[model samples]
Target: MRITIANHKGGAGKTTATVNLAAALAELDKRVLVVDMDPQANASRRLARPFDRDAPQLTASEVVRSGEEGVAAQAIAPSGWPSPYTELVSVLPARFDLDNRVSEAGTVGAVGRLRRALQGVDDEYDYTLIDAQPSLGHLTQMAFAASQRVLVVVEPEYDSVEGALRVRDFVKGYAQDLGQPDLRVLAYLVNRARRVGEHAFQLEGLADRLEGDVWTPHIPEWTAAKDAASSALPLQICGSARGPEMATLWTELAKQIIVEGAA
Candidate 1:
Protein backbone atom coordinates (compact mmCIF):
# COMPACT_ATOMS: atom_id res chain seq x y z
CA MET A 1 0.00 0.00 0.00
CA ARG A 2 1.02 3.58 -0.62
CA ILE A 3 0.22 5.87 2.30
CA THR A 4 0.94 9.56 2.76
CA ILE A 5 1.79 10.65 6.30
CA ALA A 6 0.78 14.31 6.40
CA ASN A 7 -0.45 17.31 8.38
CA HIS A 8 -1.21 20.92 7.55
CA LYS A 9 0.43 22.06 10.78
CA GLY A 10 4.17 22.20 11.31
CA GLY A 11 5.68 20.17 14.18
CA ALA A 12 2.84 17.66 14.06
CA GLY A 13 5.44 14.84 13.92
CA LYS A 14 4.83 13.78 10.34
CA THR A 15 8.46 12.86 9.65
CA THR A 16 8.75 11.24 13.04
CA ALA A 17 5.80 8.99 12.29
CA THR A 18 7.01 8.20 8.79
CA VAL A 19 10.52 7.22 9.82
CA ASN A 20 9.60 5.27 12.94
CA LEU A 21 6.71 3.54 11.25
CA ALA A 22 9.01 2.45 8.44
CA ALA A 23 11.40 1.12 11.04
CA ALA A 24 8.62 -0.76 12.78
CA LEU A 25 7.52 -2.26 9.51
CA ALA A 26 11.08 -3.29 8.80
CA GLU A 27 11.22 -5.06 12.14
CA LEU A 28 8.23 -7.07 10.97
CA ASP A 29 10.32 -8.18 7.97
CA LYS A 30 8.53 -5.92 5.54
CA ARG A 31 10.19 -4.06 2.69
CA VAL A 32 9.45 -0.35 2.85
CA LEU A 33 9.97 2.52 0.45
CA VAL A 34 10.01 5.97 2.04
CA VAL A 35 9.44 8.80 -0.40
CA ASP A 36 10.47 12.10 1.04
CA MET A 37 8.21 14.83 -0.36
CA ASP A 38 9.18 17.53 2.10
CA PRO A 39 11.86 19.90 0.91
CA GLN A 40 13.27 20.06 4.42
CA ALA A 41 14.30 16.44 3.78
CA ASN A 42 14.19 15.32 7.37
CA ALA A 43 13.17 11.79 6.32
CA SER A 44 15.93 11.65 3.72
CA ARG A 45 18.52 12.89 6.15
CA ARG A 46 17.44 10.36 8.73
CA LEU A 47 17.10 7.37 6.39
CA ALA A 48 19.45 7.97 3.47
CA ARG A 49 22.94 6.44 3.35
CA PRO A 50 25.76 8.99 3.49
CA PHE A 51 23.23 11.73 4.26
CA ASP A 52 25.84 14.37 5.07
CA ARG A 53 28.85 14.86 2.80
CA ASP A 54 28.23 12.11 0.23
CA ALA A 55 24.59 12.84 -0.61
CA PRO A 56 22.49 10.90 -3.07
CA GLN A 57 23.19 11.68 -6.69
CA LEU A 58 19.52 11.24 -7.66
CA THR A 59 16.55 12.11 -5.50
CA ALA A 60 12.79 12.60 -5.51
CA SER A 61 13.41 15.99 -7.12
CA GLU A 62 14.75 14.34 -10.24
CA VAL A 63 12.02 11.70 -10.23
CA VAL A 64 9.16 14.20 -10.01
CA ARG A 65 10.77 16.61 -12.43
CA SER A 66 11.37 13.80 -14.86
CA GLY A 67 7.69 12.80 -14.73
CA GLU A 68 8.65 9.61 -16.47
CA GLU A 69 7.18 6.22 -15.70
CA GLY A 70 9.41 4.09 -13.44
CA VAL A 71 11.98 6.88 -13.04
CA ALA A 72 11.71 6.39 -9.28
CA ALA A 73 13.65 3.13 -9.67
CA GLN A 74 16.80 5.07 -10.43
CA ALA A 75 16.53 7.29 -7.37
CA ILE A 76 15.70 4.61 -4.80
CA ALA A 77 18.58 3.69 -2.46
CA PRO A 78 19.15 1.71 0.72
CA SER A 79 18.61 3.54 3.98
CA GLY A 80 21.46 4.40 6.35
CA TRP A 81 20.35 1.97 9.02
CA PRO A 82 22.57 -1.04 9.77
CA SER A 83 22.50 -4.54 8.28
CA PRO A 84 18.98 -6.00 8.02
CA TYR A 85 17.29 -2.61 8.09
CA THR A 86 19.65 -1.32 5.42
CA GLU A 87 18.40 -4.15 3.21
CA LEU A 88 14.73 -3.81 4.20
CA VAL A 89 14.19 -0.05 3.95
CA SER A 90 14.81 2.19 0.94
CA VAL A 91 14.38 5.93 0.42
CA LEU A 92 13.75 8.29 -2.44
CA PRO A 93 15.79 11.06 -0.89
CA ALA A 94 14.91 14.74 -1.21
CA ARG A 95 16.99 17.90 -0.99
CA PHE A 96 16.19 21.59 -0.48
CA ASP A 97 15.78 22.11 -4.21
CA LEU A 98 12.79 19.75 -4.24
CA ASP A 99 10.72 22.80 -3.35
CA ASN A 100 11.24 24.01 -6.91
CA ARG A 101 8.46 21.69 -8.12
CA VAL A 102 5.94 24.09 -6.54
CA SER A 103 6.53 26.54 -9.37
CA GLU A 104 5.38 23.98 -11.94
CA ALA A 105 1.99 23.44 -10.31
CA GLY A 106 0.30 25.50 -12.98
CA THR A 107 1.46 23.26 -15.78
CA VAL A 108 -0.91 20.74 -17.27
CA GLY A 109 -0.67 17.31 -15.63
CA ALA A 110 1.75 18.68 -13.05
CA VAL A 111 -0.15 17.21 -10.14
CA GLY A 112 0.26 13.71 -11.56
CA ARG A 113 3.99 13.92 -12.08
CA LEU A 114 5.01 12.02 -8.99
CA ARG A 115 2.41 9.37 -9.56
CA ARG A 116 3.63 8.85 -13.08
CA ALA A 117 7.22 8.69 -11.94
CA LEU A 118 6.41 5.97 -9.42
CA GLN A 119 4.46 3.68 -11.69
CA GLY A 120 5.77 0.09 -11.63
CA VAL A 121 8.61 1.16 -9.34
CA ASP A 122 7.27 0.00 -5.98
CA ASP A 123 6.06 -3.48 -6.78
CA GLU A 124 8.73 -5.14 -4.67
CA TYR A 125 8.03 -3.15 -1.54
CA ASP A 126 5.34 -4.10 0.94
CA TYR A 127 4.51 -0.46 1.61
CA THR A 128 5.40 2.99 0.27
CA LEU A 129 5.14 5.83 2.78
CA ILE A 130 5.23 9.38 1.46
CA ASP A 131 6.10 12.06 4.00
CA ALA A 132 4.46 15.30 2.93
CA GLN A 133 5.40 18.80 3.99
CA PRO A 134 3.27 20.68 6.51
CA SER A 135 0.88 22.17 3.99
CA LEU A 136 -1.71 21.37 1.33
CA GLY A 137 0.40 22.93 -1.41
CA HIS A 138 1.54 21.67 -4.80
CA LEU A 139 4.27 19.44 -3.39
CA THR A 140 1.81 17.87 -1.00
CA GLN A 141 -0.67 17.48 -3.84
CA MET A 142 1.88 15.48 -5.75
CA ALA A 143 2.45 13.30 -2.71
CA PHE A 144 -1.28 12.81 -2.31
CA ALA A 145 -1.58 12.04 -5.98
CA ALA A 146 0.97 9.26 -5.60
CA SER A 147 -0.69 7.74 -2.56
CA GLN A 148 -3.54 5.30 -2.12
CA ARG A 149 -4.43 6.58 1.34
CA VAL A 150 -3.40 9.17 3.94
CA LEU A 151 -2.45 8.82 7.56
CA VAL A 152 -3.00 12.21 9.14
CA VAL A 153 -0.79 12.99 12.15
CA VAL A 154 -1.58 15.63 14.76
CA GLU A 155 -0.66 16.70 18.25
CA PRO A 156 -3.54 16.37 20.70
CA GLU A 157 -4.34 20.09 20.84
CA TYR A 158 -6.67 22.67 19.35
CA ASP A 159 -4.67 23.92 16.36
CA SER A 160 -3.42 20.43 15.58
CA VAL A 161 -6.92 18.97 15.74
CA GLU A 162 -8.13 21.72 13.43
CA GLY A 163 -5.29 20.99 11.06
CA ALA A 164 -6.16 17.28 10.96
CA LEU A 165 -9.78 18.11 10.19
CA ARG A 166 -8.67 20.43 7.43
CA VAL A 167 -6.61 17.64 5.91
CA ARG A 168 -9.57 15.26 6.18
CA ASP A 169 -11.94 17.64 4.45
CA PHE A 170 -9.43 18.74 1.86
CA VAL A 171 -8.62 15.17 0.84
CA LYS A 172 -12.30 14.42 0.40
CA GLY A 173 -12.75 17.22 -2.12
CA TYR A 174 -9.32 17.44 -3.67
CA ALA A 175 -8.95 13.74 -4.36
CA GLN A 176 -11.87 13.89 -6.72
CA ASP A 177 -10.40 16.95 -8.41
CA LEU A 178 -7.11 15.11 -8.76
CA GLY A 179 -9.00 12.22 -10.39
CA GLN A 180 -8.19 9.96 -7.47
CA PRO A 181 -11.71 9.55 -6.19
CA ASP A 182 -10.74 6.53 -4.10
CA LEU A 183 -8.04 8.34 -2.15
CA ARG A 184 -9.14 8.95 1.44
CA VAL A 185 -7.89 9.52 4.97
CA LEU A 186 -7.23 5.97 6.22
CA ALA A 187 -6.67 7.04 9.83
CA TYR A 188 -5.66 9.84 12.20
CA LEU A 189 -2.61 9.27 14.42
CA VAL A 190 -2.33 11.32 17.58
CA ASN A 191 1.34 12.16 18.04
CA ARG A 192 3.08 13.81 20.98
CA ALA A 193 0.09 13.10 23.20
CA ARG A 194 0.25 13.93 26.87
CA ARG A 195 -1.58 13.22 30.12
CA VAL A 196 -2.75 16.78 30.60
CA GLY A 197 -6.43 17.68 30.95
CA GLU A 198 -6.48 19.63 27.68
CA HIS A 199 -4.93 16.73 25.83
CA ALA A 200 -7.51 14.38 27.32
CA PHE A 201 -10.31 16.63 26.17
CA GLN A 202 -8.90 17.02 22.69
CA LEU A 203 -8.31 13.28 22.35
CA GLU A 204 -11.90 12.61 23.34
CA GLY A 205 -13.13 15.33 21.02
CA LEU A 206 -11.07 14.03 18.11
CA ALA A 207 -12.36 10.52 18.67
CA ASP A 208 -15.96 11.73 18.78
CA ARG A 209 -15.38 13.86 15.72
CA LEU A 210 -13.69 11.21 13.55
CA GLU A 211 -15.31 8.13 15.03
CA GLY A 212 -13.56 4.90 14.05
CA ASP A 213 -10.91 6.68 12.04
CA VAL A 214 -8.92 7.75 15.10
CA TRP A 215 -6.22 5.21 15.85
CA THR A 216 -5.94 3.85 19.35
CA PRO A 217 -2.79 3.97 21.55
CA HIS A 218 -1.76 7.52 20.84
CA ILE A 219 1.99 8.20 20.51
CA PRO A 220 3.23 9.90 23.68
CA GLU A 221 5.37 12.99 23.98
CA TRP A 222 8.82 11.54 24.66
CA THR A 223 12.42 12.59 24.50
CA ALA A 224 13.22 9.25 22.87
CA ALA A 225 11.71 10.39 19.60
CA LYS A 226 13.98 13.42 19.48
CA ASP A 227 16.99 11.37 20.41
CA ALA A 228 16.24 8.76 17.76
CA ALA A 229 15.90 11.36 15.02
CA SER A 230 18.98 13.31 16.06
CA SER A 231 21.06 10.17 16.30
CA ALA A 232 19.78 8.87 12.93
CA LEU A 233 18.64 5.61 14.52
CA PRO A 234 15.33 3.81 14.79
CA LEU A 235 13.44 3.94 18.05
CA GLN A 236 14.13 0.23 18.47
CA ILE A 237 17.87 0.92 18.71
CA CYS A 238 18.05 4.53 19.88
CA GLY A 239 19.36 3.36 23.30
CA SER A 240 17.16 5.83 25.18
CA ALA A 241 15.41 4.46 28.25
CA ARG A 242 11.93 4.76 26.75
CA GLY A 243 13.00 3.94 23.20
CA PRO A 244 11.76 0.33 23.36
CA GLU A 245 8.36 1.47 24.63
CA MET A 246 8.04 3.89 21.74
CA ALA A 247 9.26 1.25 19.32
CA THR A 248 6.60 -1.16 20.58
CA LEU A 249 3.91 1.45 19.97
CA TRP A 250 5.06 1.95 16.40
CA THR A 251 5.29 -1.81 15.82
CA GLU A 252 1.71 -2.23 16.96
CA LEU A 253 0.66 0.57 14.66
CA ALA A 254 2.50 -1.09 11.79
CA LYS A 255 0.63 -4.33 12.43
CA GLN A 256 -2.63 -2.41 12.32
CA ILE A 257 -1.60 -0.85 9.00
CA ILE A 258 -0.77 -4.27 7.60
CA VAL A 259 -4.17 -5.60 8.58
CA GLU A 260 -6.01 -2.60 7.20
CA GLY A 261 -4.08 -2.65 3.97
CA ALA A 262 -4.95 -6.29 3.51
CA ALA A 263 -8.60 -5.47 4.11
Candidate 2:
Protein backbone atom coordinates (compact mmCIF):
# COMPACT_ATOMS: atom_id res chain seq x y z
CA MET A 1 0.00 0.00 0.00
CA ARG A 2 1.20 3.50 -0.85
CA ILE A 3 -0.01 5.69 2.01
CA THR A 4 0.53 9.42 2.10
CA ILE A 5 0.53 11.13 5.50
CA ALA A 6 -0.21 14.79 4.89
CA ASN A 7 -1.45 18.06 6.37
CA HIS A 8 -1.32 21.56 4.88
CA LYS A 9 -0.36 23.10 8.22
CA GLY A 10 2.88 22.81 10.15
CA GLY A 11 3.13 21.29 13.66
CA ALA A 12 0.52 18.68 12.74
CA GLY A 13 2.75 15.75 13.72
CA LYS A 14 2.70 14.42 10.15
CA THR A 15 6.39 13.46 9.98
CA THR A 16 6.37 12.02 13.49
CA ALA A 17 3.39 9.86 12.61
CA THR A 18 4.98 8.74 9.34
CA VAL A 19 8.27 7.78 10.96
CA ASN A 20 6.73 5.99 13.92
CA LEU A 21 4.03 4.22 11.95
CA ALA A 22 6.53 2.93 9.40
CA ALA A 23 8.75 1.76 12.23
CA ALA A 24 5.85 0.12 14.01
CA LEU A 25 4.77 -1.71 10.88
CA ALA A 26 8.33 -2.78 10.21
CA GLU A 27 8.51 -4.17 13.73
CA LEU A 28 5.49 -6.23 12.80
CA ASP A 29 7.67 -7.74 10.06
CA LYS A 30 6.32 -5.66 7.21
CA ARG A 31 8.75 -4.56 4.51
CA VAL A 32 8.42 -0.80 4.60
CA LEU A 33 9.83 2.17 2.68
CA VAL A 34 9.43 5.78 3.81
CA VAL A 35 9.64 8.48 1.14
CA ASP A 36 10.47 11.85 2.62
CA MET A 37 8.48 14.22 0.43
CA ASP A 38 9.03 17.18 2.71
CA PRO A 39 11.89 19.46 1.74
CA GLN A 40 12.65 19.99 5.46
CA ALA A 41 13.92 16.37 5.53
CA ASN A 42 12.86 15.76 9.14
CA ALA A 43 12.01 12.14 8.37
CA SER A 44 15.38 11.62 6.67
CA ARG A 45 17.14 13.10 9.71
CA ARG A 46 15.17 10.79 11.97
CA LEU A 47 16.68 7.93 9.99
CA ALA A 48 20.21 9.25 10.80
CA ARG A 49 20.55 11.55 7.78
CA PRO A 50 21.98 9.24 5.15
CA PHE A 51 23.96 11.48 2.82
CA ASP A 52 26.53 10.49 0.18
CA ARG A 53 28.49 13.73 0.02
CA ASP A 54 31.56 12.24 -1.63
CA ALA A 55 29.83 11.42 -4.90
CA PRO A 56 26.63 12.06 -6.87
CA GLN A 57 23.81 10.77 -4.67
CA LEU A 58 20.14 10.07 -5.09
CA THR A 59 17.69 12.31 -3.27
CA ALA A 60 14.01 13.14 -3.61
CA SER A 61 14.85 16.26 -5.59
CA GLU A 62 16.87 14.26 -8.07
CA VAL A 63 14.27 11.50 -8.29
CA VAL A 64 11.51 13.90 -9.27
CA ARG A 65 13.86 15.95 -11.39
CA SER A 66 14.96 12.93 -13.39
CA GLY A 67 12.77 11.68 -16.20
CA GLU A 68 15.00 8.67 -16.66
CA GLU A 69 13.53 5.21 -16.21
CA GLY A 70 13.85 3.42 -12.85
CA VAL A 71 15.12 6.46 -10.94
CA ALA A 72 13.53 5.28 -7.68
CA ALA A 73 15.72 2.20 -7.73
CA GLN A 74 18.70 4.48 -7.12
CA ALA A 75 16.96 6.66 -4.55
CA ILE A 76 16.36 4.06 -1.81
CA ALA A 77 18.82 3.43 1.06
CA PRO A 78 18.71 1.16 4.11
CA SER A 79 17.35 3.05 7.14
CA GLY A 80 20.05 1.75 9.60
CA TRP A 81 17.49 2.03 12.39
CA PRO A 82 18.93 -0.84 14.50
CA SER A 83 15.53 -2.44 14.81
CA PRO A 84 14.75 -5.83 16.34
CA TYR A 85 14.92 -7.16 12.79
CA THR A 86 17.73 -6.33 10.42
CA GLU A 87 16.75 -4.34 7.32
CA LEU A 88 13.39 -3.56 8.81
CA VAL A 89 12.79 -0.41 6.81
CA SER A 90 14.36 1.95 4.29
CA VAL A 91 13.97 5.67 3.51
CA LEU A 92 14.24 7.78 0.35
CA PRO A 93 16.19 10.72 1.70
CA ALA A 94 15.29 14.33 0.93
CA ARG A 95 17.26 17.58 0.96
CA PHE A 96 16.58 21.31 1.08
CA ASP A 97 17.32 21.60 -2.67
CA LEU A 98 13.92 19.91 -3.14
CA ASP A 99 12.26 23.19 -2.20
CA ASN A 100 13.72 25.02 -5.17
CA ARG A 101 13.01 22.12 -7.54
CA VAL A 102 9.40 21.95 -6.33
CA SER A 103 8.96 25.67 -6.91
CA GLU A 104 10.18 25.49 -10.51
CA ALA A 105 7.55 25.13 -13.25
CA GLY A 106 9.85 23.55 -15.81
CA THR A 107 8.90 19.89 -15.53
CA VAL A 108 6.60 18.60 -18.23
CA GLY A 109 4.76 15.98 -16.16
CA ALA A 110 5.20 17.64 -12.79
CA VAL A 111 2.41 16.07 -10.72
CA GLY A 112 2.69 12.66 -12.34
CA ARG A 113 6.45 12.29 -12.11
CA LEU A 114 6.45 10.80 -8.64
CA ARG A 115 4.04 8.05 -9.56
CA ARG A 116 6.07 7.17 -12.60
CA ALA A 117 9.30 7.15 -10.66
CA LEU A 118 8.00 4.83 -7.98
CA GLN A 119 6.28 2.43 -10.33
CA GLY A 120 9.49 0.45 -10.88
CA VAL A 121 10.00 -0.15 -7.17
CA ASP A 122 6.58 0.11 -5.59
CA ASP A 123 6.27 -3.63 -5.09
CA GLU A 124 9.55 -3.90 -3.17
CA TYR A 125 7.80 -3.06 0.09
CA ASP A 126 4.57 -4.17 1.66
CA TYR A 127 3.89 -0.57 2.59
CA THR A 128 5.35 2.72 1.39
CA LEU A 129 4.78 5.88 3.42
CA ILE A 130 5.09 9.33 1.88
CA ASP A 131 5.90 12.07 4.40
CA ALA A 132 4.57 15.10 2.54
CA GLN A 133 5.36 18.77 3.07
CA PRO A 134 3.13 21.12 5.07
CA SER A 135 1.47 22.76 2.12
CA LEU A 136 -0.91 22.07 -0.81
CA GLY A 137 1.58 22.61 -3.59
CA HIS A 138 2.25 20.48 -6.67
CA LEU A 139 4.63 18.45 -4.52
CA THR A 140 1.77 17.46 -2.23
CA GLN A 141 -0.53 16.95 -5.21
CA MET A 142 2.03 14.59 -6.67
CA ALA A 143 1.86 12.56 -3.46
CA PHE A 144 -1.92 12.53 -3.55
CA ALA A 145 -1.94 11.50 -7.19
CA ALA A 146 0.38 8.60 -6.45
CA SER A 147 -1.15 7.37 -3.20
CA GLN A 148 -3.40 4.37 -2.71
CA ARG A 149 -4.35 5.60 0.76
CA VAL A 150 -4.29 9.05 2.34
CA LEU A 151 -4.01 9.71 6.09
CA VAL A 152 -4.56 13.18 7.46
CA VAL A 153 -2.75 13.80 10.75
CA VAL A 154 -4.23 16.55 12.85
CA GLU A 155 -3.58 17.91 16.31
CA PRO A 156 -6.55 18.67 18.53
CA GLU A 157 -7.23 22.27 17.52
CA TYR A 158 -9.81 24.11 15.43
CA ASP A 159 -7.24 24.99 12.78
CA SER A 160 -6.06 21.43 12.68
CA VAL A 161 -9.62 20.30 12.24
CA GLU A 162 -9.90 22.61 9.25
CA GLY A 163 -6.56 21.42 7.92
CA ALA A 164 -7.70 17.84 8.10
CA LEU A 165 -10.85 18.69 6.20
CA ARG A 166 -8.84 20.47 3.55
CA VAL A 167 -6.60 17.43 3.11
CA ARG A 168 -9.61 15.13 2.79
CA ASP A 169 -11.03 17.43 0.14
CA PHE A 170 -7.71 17.61 -1.65
CA VAL A 171 -7.57 13.86 -2.04
CA LYS A 172 -11.11 13.73 -3.33
CA GLY A 173 -10.66 16.63 -5.72
CA TYR A 174 -7.28 15.48 -6.97
CA ALA A 175 -8.60 12.03 -7.74
CA GLN A 176 -11.63 13.44 -9.48
CA ASP A 177 -9.45 15.77 -11.48
CA LEU A 178 -7.32 12.83 -12.55
CA GLY A 179 -10.44 10.79 -13.34
CA GLN A 180 -9.72 8.47 -10.44
CA PRO A 181 -12.93 9.04 -8.55
CA ASP A 182 -12.31 5.97 -6.41
CA LEU A 183 -9.58 7.74 -4.50
CA ARG A 184 -10.47 9.22 -1.11
CA VAL A 185 -9.15 9.67 2.40
CA LEU A 186 -8.44 6.20 3.78
CA ALA A 187 -8.49 7.59 7.35
CA TYR A 188 -7.76 10.55 9.64
CA LEU A 189 -5.28 10.20 12.51
CA VAL A 190 -5.60 12.31 15.62
CA ASN A 191 -2.23 13.04 17.20
CA ARG A 192 -1.22 14.52 20.55
CA ALA A 193 -4.76 14.42 21.83
CA ARG A 194 -5.24 15.59 25.39
CA ARG A 195 -8.14 15.57 27.83
CA VAL A 196 -8.04 19.32 28.38
CA GLY A 197 -11.04 21.48 27.46
CA GLU A 198 -10.44 22.63 23.90
CA HIS A 199 -8.32 19.67 22.99
CA ALA A 200 -10.88 17.16 24.19
CA PHE A 201 -13.71 19.09 22.53
CA GLN A 202 -11.94 19.22 19.18
CA LEU A 203 -11.08 15.51 19.30
CA GLU A 204 -14.68 14.66 20.03
CA GLY A 205 -15.90 16.90 17.23
CA LEU A 206 -13.46 15.36 14.72
CA ALA A 207 -14.47 11.85 15.68
CA ASP A 208 -18.11 12.76 15.28
CA ARG A 209 -17.45 14.36 11.92
CA LEU A 210 -15.29 11.59 10.46
CA GLU A 211 -17.14 8.66 12.04
CA GLY A 212 -15.58 5.27 11.18
CA ASP A 213 -12.82 6.84 9.12
CA VAL A 214 -11.06 8.24 12.22
CA TRP A 215 -8.26 6.01 13.49
CA THR A 216 -8.35 4.89 17.13
CA PRO A 217 -5.94 4.69 20.08
CA HIS A 218 -5.16 8.37 19.63
CA ILE A 219 -1.64 9.46 20.56
CA PRO A 220 -1.46 11.48 23.79
CA GLU A 221 0.62 14.50 24.72
CA TRP A 222 3.91 12.87 25.73
CA THR A 223 7.52 13.91 26.00
CA ALA A 224 8.77 10.54 24.77
CA ALA A 225 8.02 11.61 21.20
CA LYS A 226 10.32 14.58 21.42
CA ASP A 227 12.92 12.53 23.26
CA ALA A 228 12.86 9.93 20.50
CA ALA A 229 13.21 12.55 17.78
CA SER A 230 16.09 14.29 19.55
CA SER A 231 17.91 10.97 19.89
CA ALA A 232 17.31 10.03 16.23
CA LEU A 233 15.21 7.00 17.07
CA PRO A 234 11.81 5.59 16.32
CA LEU A 235 9.52 5.75 19.32
CA GLN A 236 9.23 1.96 19.29
CA ILE A 237 12.97 1.56 19.71
CA CYS A 238 13.70 4.64 21.80
CA GLY A 239 12.87 2.82 25.06
CA SER A 240 9.90 5.09 25.42
CA ALA A 241 7.77 4.66 28.52
CA ARG A 242 4.78 4.51 26.19
CA GLY A 243 6.40 1.93 23.96
CA PRO A 244 3.90 -0.87 24.52
CA GLU A 245 0.97 1.52 24.27
CA MET A 246 2.18 2.98 21.00
CA ALA A 247 2.96 -0.47 19.65
CA THR A 248 -0.58 -1.64 20.20
CA LEU A 249 -1.94 1.62 18.81
CA TRP A 250 0.09 1.42 15.60
CA THR A 251 -0.57 -2.29 15.08
CA GLU A 252 -4.23 -1.48 15.14
CA LEU A 253 -3.57 1.26 12.61
CA ALA A 254 -1.63 -1.09 10.34
CA LYS A 255 -4.33 -3.73 10.29
CA GLN A 256 -6.98 -1.10 9.63
CA ILE A 257 -5.01 0.25 6.70
CA ILE A 258 -4.56 -3.18 5.18
CA VAL A 259 -8.20 -4.14 5.49
CA GLU A 260 -9.68 -0.79 4.48
CA GLY A 261 -7.28 -0.15 1.64
CA ALA A 262 -7.72 -3.68 0.39
CA ALA A 263 -11.42 -3.06 0.18
**TM of each candidate vs. truth:** 0.97, 0.92
Candidate 1 lDDT tens digits, 1-263: 89999889999999999999999999999999999999899998778443454533788888899899899999899998997899999999988889898998998999999999999999999999999999999999998988889999989889988888889888988998876888988899989999999998988768678553788778999999999998889988889999999999999889989998677
lDDT of each: 0.90, 0.80
Deviation (Å) of 247 in candidate 2: 3.2
Model 1: CA > 4 A from native: 48-56
Candidate 1: global Cα-lDDT?
A: 0.90
* Collision pairs in model 2: none
Candidate 2 local lDDT, 1-263, one digit each (tens): 88889888888999888888887787778888899888888998887655657754689899988745568879888885784533878888898888876765456667777788888686878889999998888778778777877888988898888888788777766786643566678888888888899997887667677543788878887888887777778776678788666656777877777677778
